[model samples]
Target: MIEIDELLQQEAWRFWDQSLSGKSKSALESFAADDLLCHLVGQGQSPATVRTWVHDQTVVLGIQDHRLPFVDDAQDFLRTQGFTPIVRNSGGLAVVLDAGVLNISIVLSELVQPIDISAGYEVMLEFVRLLLPEAEGKIEAYEIVGSYCPGSYDLSIDGKKFAGISQRRLRKGIAVQIYLCIDGSGSERAELIRQFYDIGVQGEDTKFTYPDIKPEVMASINELLGTSFTIQDIVIRIQQLLQHLTPKVISQSITEDEVALYQFYMQRVLDRNKKMLEK
Candidate 1:
């Protein structure tokens, strides 16, 4: 496994905090932004980047989610519950994102050497441990059964998951993204996804097995660690952590050229999502 320090041994690191970019910046844009960053980083046009983002009430669905028997009804249920439903251009089942969830994407270039998928996940897991030294040994990475978007890289404590890691590789760049439930009741969030699956599947078995969500297995970091931390507090921690890792931490937004690329990626994501939801 490539150590986190080894990954951060670069000359400089780019940092972008879009957590408070307002409600206009949807979660859809966040995924698109990562896609753009991945292309630039992979092409050696931009340094490795760490972007933090948060969205309002939203349920980011996976590709498989769009295949639910009654997906339209499930999405409508989400809308009636005051949450915007959008299919993410990545791998993972549905996940709840709101003001309290802090999403961090570490974009790395693999132009010179290929990165194994597990290595990418390991790097992000180690980085998360560094961010919260308080929960050093307690943070365990394993599949938390009965949790929404259950994966082998589920970040959990005492069997309750607080985060899940997903990866997107494009144009020789890898975007390792993790959404941390920083605040609120994790079980409540899990329950929402449980309901979504219930409505979408309608108890009908399918070729692809969906998770039988057990809300008790889900929790926020605050709930797991017994600490009161906000998204802003974690943002500061991320900056400090990166500053220690690299000599220079550049706090900049996307350039004009990047904006043009972002638009292209955004349209792709928008189009893909429109097609999925329309089904």
Candidate 2:
């Protein structure tokens, strides 16, 4: 695992805003570096970066998702319903994103030692448990059956999954990211994935395996806490915990060099998308 001190001092954190922060061209102009590696909260992140923004009503889809038997139909349904269908350049299937979910990025620089993907995930999960010790037992780290984006590190409570992780490597950087559905109805999010699978697969037996999503096996942190807790609230907690781990947890934005790199990366991401469409 890359030490916290090293991460704090490295150009990775100082370079880019992972994916979410590099929203616009200008934002990218200031927040990306040649070494910026992205770990998406869903499938893959590396080389450039993987970012999972917890925006409201956004449904992230895996590459195979674009190949749904009724691809256009599903896309139209999502579009009409105000859900943007974004094809991800990583592993895994469809997953939900919302304000209630806490999206985390494990940005990496190519200059650093190569850490195993599973190790990167463990580090992020450890940070979560460290940040919120009260929910130690409640925060289970195991694959929940019948969940979209099922993985070994799925964060769940009482057999309910609330988080799914993915990674993205680009150029030479890496971003390992995860989005945890906190403080809301996990079942609702699960139901969304369920519908996506139902509408996309339609009982097809392809080489890939799509999850038979179970909405009941998911719950929000709020419900688990028996109190109302927002993602922003948890963000503060995360910042505080990180501050404790280091003396200078500065809140600095990205630099111009990073932004230029982000533009290049954005183009690459777009190009990648174009290729998929062509196929």
The candidate scoring highest on TM-score is 1
- Model 1 residue 28 CA deviation in Å: 1.2
Clashes of each: 0, 35
- Show where candidate 1 strays beyond 4 Å: 1-3
RMSD of 1: 1.2
- Compared with the true structure, all predictions reach lDDT values of 0.91, 0.62
Candidate 1 lDDT over 41-77, as tens digits, reads 9999999999999998999999899999999899899
Model 2 TM-score (2 dp)? 0.81
Q: Estimate, for each residue in 1-279, the C-alpha lDDT of model 2 and write its tens digit.
A: 566445433332221222344332222221233224342211223222223334566777778887778767677777777666667555677877655766666566554466666666766777677767778767778889898788888888778777776665554445667777777788887877777777777787777777788888888777776767766677667666655655444454444544665566667666666676565
